[model samples]
Target: MVFLKILMERSRLPVKNFKEQIMSTIHDNPVVIIQGATGCGKTTQIPQYILDEFIQAGRASECNIVVTQVSLLKCVLILCARSP
Candidate 1:
């Protein structure tokens, strides 16, 4: 889709430093720090990226993705708004 294409175009994972260092650290470490400016696509894009990769690898049902936020009300509101 158009959104996926846009995400791919702007993805920071393509950068060698980010891919090699940050991603590897995330894979190897129990906790990782991913700091970026607001609207930098960290929250939105990372989950989708992981989901897509999991699906592509035929492990969509087996994998569990947990996205947590501090604000429960905001999370509920966003989930409600996105629901059909």
Candidate 2:
């Protein structure tokens, strides 16, 4: 849990400085496009940020965040195949 807490800190992300702007933009728009260089945490961090916002606003149960990655599906299939 401590490890996750440390990782949750925005300071660790390359997008840390832009966190507020990103969240604000998301709040104001129906759709948002986030583009950044590789390892910039776009894929990993943005969804977490949106979920966090919803949680803080007491609307977590109403929030449904979906992130799709083909590689993740492949990994899940591999894990399922390996399971007894």
Leading candidate by lDDT: 2
Model 1 segments more than 4 A misplaced:
1-20, 69-84
- The TM-score, computed over Cα atoms with residue i paired to residue i, of candidate 1 is 0.53
Find the candidate with the highest TM-score and give its number: 2
What are the RMSDs of all candidates, in order?
A: 7.8, 7.0
Cα lDDT over the full model 2? 0.82
Model 2 lDDT at residue 56: 97
Backbone Cα, N, C clashes tallied per candidate? 0, 0
TM-score, per-candidate, Cα-based: 0.53, 0.67
lDDT of 1 at 8: 64
Model 1: ten consecutive residues of lowest lDDT: 13-22
* RMSD score of candidate 1 (Å): 7.8
